[model samples]
Target: MLVRIRGAWFVAVGVVVAVVATALLLVTRAGADTDRCTRFRDAADDRAGLVTGVGADLLVIGDSYSVGLGVGAAESWPTRLPGRVRVGGFSGSGFSRGASPCGDVSYAARAARDLPESEIVVVEGGLNDFDQPAAAVEDGFERLLARLDDRRVLVVGPAPAPERAAAVPAVDALLADLAREHGVGYLSMAEADLPYLDDGLHLTVEGHRQFGDLVAGALSTARQPGR
Candidate 1:
């Protein structure tokens, strides 16, 4: 059983053996401004896994979708970023965990207490929060963005999955509004040029690769002068 906790893998294994994802993280907060990285790495042992360390000023956080659960290690958009980036996040995480069975900590809490410094931070998570009241998630999301202060943040809404087709738009709208309010970038994954898998919860490797390019383009345009 997959516990609704950060760094805990939740993929329902159906075969005798399966590959374990290496893009996992465990962070602990100390004081009001210290987020120590407990663990974050790719499963290099896996045939398709890739090893990449974090040190760059780019941080990406979100749930299993953003963690690239269904794709190869290097095929993940985060791992495939054009430049070096400090990637650290967990699957099953979201904006805020109310009665949801997906996460125990809100993305806002994680951002406020357990994130490293970065000029650009891409946050993508809201599927778990979609069932909850929008206002509640908005509250946490606002605080999350506020904590970043001067940092540039890009809100990547939940990917367009068959399961979330009907409900993701609302969350995406909410994020778009927040992006405007905070003068940040909001990339609507719903409109992203990608394809989904059979489960409809994850994206294909080609999809991720293409999405990575789109994300890179959006980030560049969003960072432009008077864009």
Candidate 2:
């Protein structure tokens, strides 16, 4: 009888262990699936028909700064840009090699795939590359511009940060050189007078308005006649 009891106890423990292991495996799988789903959903939402019905012949691509951080989509500079500009920016996006926080897609790859053939292609991104080596930043920018081919590109330099304003000039100069080398237009928002930049990085609502106006002025001058 004691032998039978021992056997039963062993069986019960084995079953319990198996159940716990299965539960753990299932939980892990569910978490991974959830993460992949979230990434895909965010990418899909970001890539949704932004240019539809806008009559945009221009495409704008960049990180949160270019998208008008802390502001609604309507208040973005691309939205406010004259001649129906379509915006293809994602927040927290960088020109890094690893998986993007905004999505699983690489910024350069996404730009090549999603960017429309436009007379004007505004490429803005660099702040996120602060920690990365300057070579990496330049390489990413070069790759992005390579995809533009003969298209008229505009490389908007980084914004001014009170802590980094001194360094801003060098970064802006690099971007300017890149644009010139690629034969594209360049806009330096770092020189613009925008008092609405909170924390010297992201823009406030008023800042967004000011950026939109700045972009509008640039586009007004750059846009093809009657466009």
RMSD of each: 13.8, 7.7
Best candidate according to TM-score = 1
Clashing pairs in 1: 22-43
Candidate 1's residue-wise lDDT over 147-172, tens digit each?
77677777778766778778888888
- Each prediction's number of clashing residue pairs: 1, 0
Q: Which candidate number has the best lDDT? A: 2
lDDT (C-alpha) at residue 164 in model 1: 77
Give the Cα error of residue 215 in candidate 1, in Å: 0.7
* Reference-based lDDT, each prediction: 0.63, 0.65
> Worst ten-residue run, lDDT, model 1?
32-41
Residue 145, model 2, lDDT: 65
